[model samples]
Target chain A: MWQLYQFPLCPFSRKVRLLLGEKGIGYEPVRESPWLRRDEFLDLNPTGQVPVMVDTDRGVALIDSTVICEFFEETVDKAAMLNGTAVDRAEIRRLVVWFDSNFFRDITAPLLEERMIKRLVHRTAPDARALRDAMKAAVGHLDYIDYLLDHRTWLAGPTMSLADLAAAAQISIADYLGGIDWKSHEQAKRWYVGMKSRPSFRPLLSERMDGIPPPSDYDKLDD
Target chain B: MWQLYQFPLCPFSRKVRLLLGEKGIGYEPVRESPWLRRDEFLDLNPTGQVPVMVDTDRGVALIDSTVICEFFEETVDKAAMLNGTAVDRAEIRRLVVWFDSNFFRDITAPLLEERMIKRLVHRTAPDARALRDAMKAAVGHLDYIDYLLDHRTWLAGPTMSLADLAAAAQISIADYLGGIDWKSHEQAKRWYVGMKSRPSFRPLLSERMDGIPPPSDYDKLDD
Candidate 1:
């Protein structure tokens, strides 16, 4: 039996969930609120971050979504998310880092913090200046994604990959906050529409957060 | 021949440089100013980030330091930086992510921005508020490093791994900026001293930036 501790709306957690689904791995999901800093959660992961996977059968615990995903890639080759030659794998990993780090830093972090976490955590209303900056940053990223999709069927290559999952996961959070302007980037929108129709992404699309409802077209399969 | 485009003071770049040295692979160094967003450099990496690796022999280019390091781990086996079983590798990777993301976000980024990048980029004087927060965050990280060192010979296990390289790369930048209070955390200092003494780390210690001089003890092997 495997158990995954995760937050419902965390992009990192969503990335892991999507990967697990794609791999056809079944695990019990445990929702964790890292902001609470619960002792037990901290005990499991000193960092107090979610998306911690406990492989009960293996008698091991893994933290960091990317690391956990890589572990799966290494151990289970049945449904490989990182399939390819060394260069191809590097391409996938590069985009994974880009979405998880650069994209998250520039777009997801500020928008999510302002739109969601602030309200949940009793912080003051979202900062307008921060939102403006995030909005500007997001356009560039969306345009880049459009450019990439123009050349390749998927983000990194022709096949589905962790890169697609990662980008979708991060962008999904921004989408839930109504940050993504899908119409502006048709190619990227088409790529995302393809991702949205996949069975692996179904669960994430159906997730609902109280007090912050997603836009009507948020979960739609078509742009 | 391999050529690595890097910035001398970038933590991610240093991480790659350290991993390459540890792996016993030689590559020509190409200094890149990512901030300049040179057309040629941006052509290789749309992100305009430093630490892009070009393998002339293989006719491939790779970006993202972690991605590059992972590529080396996959393709080269000379000095295994990811040495261990699956579980062990997960632990090492978790720490690498911790240092690269959490540690960098909390401590190293602010300190470097204030103490070093400000002068290099001609930004305004360091923001006092940011520096204060970074100082407080540094203490928590230093304590964590001390705790980890107390239990293990090396940061993920008895053998040196990318975990140490990543942590050291980030910390070395902090040290260069004179942000590390070595006297406050003896065990971490001792561990860092071990890392610094390695032949792999020699090149980084000798690297000199134009205006920002490292502390006198920056390159010292022994305390």
Candidate 2:
């Protein structure tokens, strides 16, 4: 049996969930609020972060979404989600880091801190300066995504891989916050539409929090 | 032949260099200042991040230090830097992410922004507030590392792995700025002394930047 601790809105958590679903793996999910630093959760993961997976069969707990996902790939050795040769896997990993680190820093993180975190923490209002900077950076990132889509069927190559999942996860969060101007980048929007239609992506598309609701078209498969 | 574009003080860049050195792989090193954002450099890596490696034999350019290091492990398959079983590899990767993402964000980054970046950009004095916050966070991080070192021969296991390289690279940067109080963490210091004595660590220890000189004890293997 496998179990995972996750927060509904964290892109890293969403990426792992999608990977498991795509591989047709079954696991129990436990929602975690890392900021609260719950004792039991901290016992499982000293990092106090989400997407920690407990693989009962292996009798080991895995921390870090990337580590957990890659562990599944190595041990299970099925589903070939990382797909292809050494160079192909390298390309996929590069794109994963690009979305997880680069995009999150310049766009998703600041926006989340202002919009979601402020609301959750009962802080007054979102910081205008942070919002402006993130939105400006988003334009460039969105354009880059569009450019990548123009050349390849997926972000890294022909087949959909972790790169696509990582990118879409962040974009999904941004879309829920009404931060993406999809109409401005048709290619990127089209690629996302394809991702939305995947059965593995279904649960994430319909996710909702207590005081937050996604946009009306948030779960739609097509424009 | 492999050629790596890197910056001397970048932790991500250093991580890759250490991995290559430990693997005993030969490569031409190109020093890059990512802040300058050179056109040719940006052409090779759209993100313009340092530590991009081009394998002319493979005819592919790899971006992201972690990705590059992992690629070498996959292709070279000689060095057992990530040696051990699947679960063991997972533990090492977890620690790598712990250092690269978590530690970088909370401590190394803010301190670099205040101390190193300020000097590089020819800006005014370091921000006292940012420096204080980073220092406070550094203590907690150092304690965690110390606790880990108390239990293990090396982080994640009995062997030196990418986890150690990733961590030592970050700490080396902090140590350069005189951020570490080695006296406070005896076990961590002892482990570091062993790492500093390794031949793989030699080049990094001797590195000197234009206006920045390491503290007197920075390069000393047996202090």
Q: Pick the candidate with the highest TM-score.
A: 2
Model 2, B38-156: lDDT tens per residue?
A: 99999999889888999788689999988998888998866578879988999999999989988888878887787788998967799888888877877888898888887889998
For residues A56-148, what per-residue lDDT tens digits would candidate 2 score against the true structure? 776889899889888888876556678899899999999999999889888888878888899998666998998888878888888999888
DockQ of candidate 1 is 0.76
Tell me how far the alpha carbon of residue A160 in candidate 2 is from the true structure, in angstroms, after superposition. 1.1
Tell me how far the alpha carbon of residue A46 in candidate 1 is from the true structure, in angstroms, after superposition.
Answer: 2.7
Q: Give candidate 2's iRMS in Å, 1 decimal.
A: 1.0
Instruction: List DockQ, one per candidate, in order.
Output: 0.76, 0.79
lDDT of 1 by residue, A38-110 (tens): 9998988988988899977878999999999998888877668897898999999999989998889988998
The residue ranges of model 2 lying beyond 4 angstroms of the native Cα positions read A56-59, B56-58
Cα deviation of A157, candidate 2, in Å: 0.7
* Predicted structure with the largest DockQ when compared to the true one: 2
TM-score result, candidate 2: 0.95
RMSD (CA, Å), candidate 1 to true, equals 2.1
Q: Name the lDDT value of residue B148 in candidate 2.
A: 86
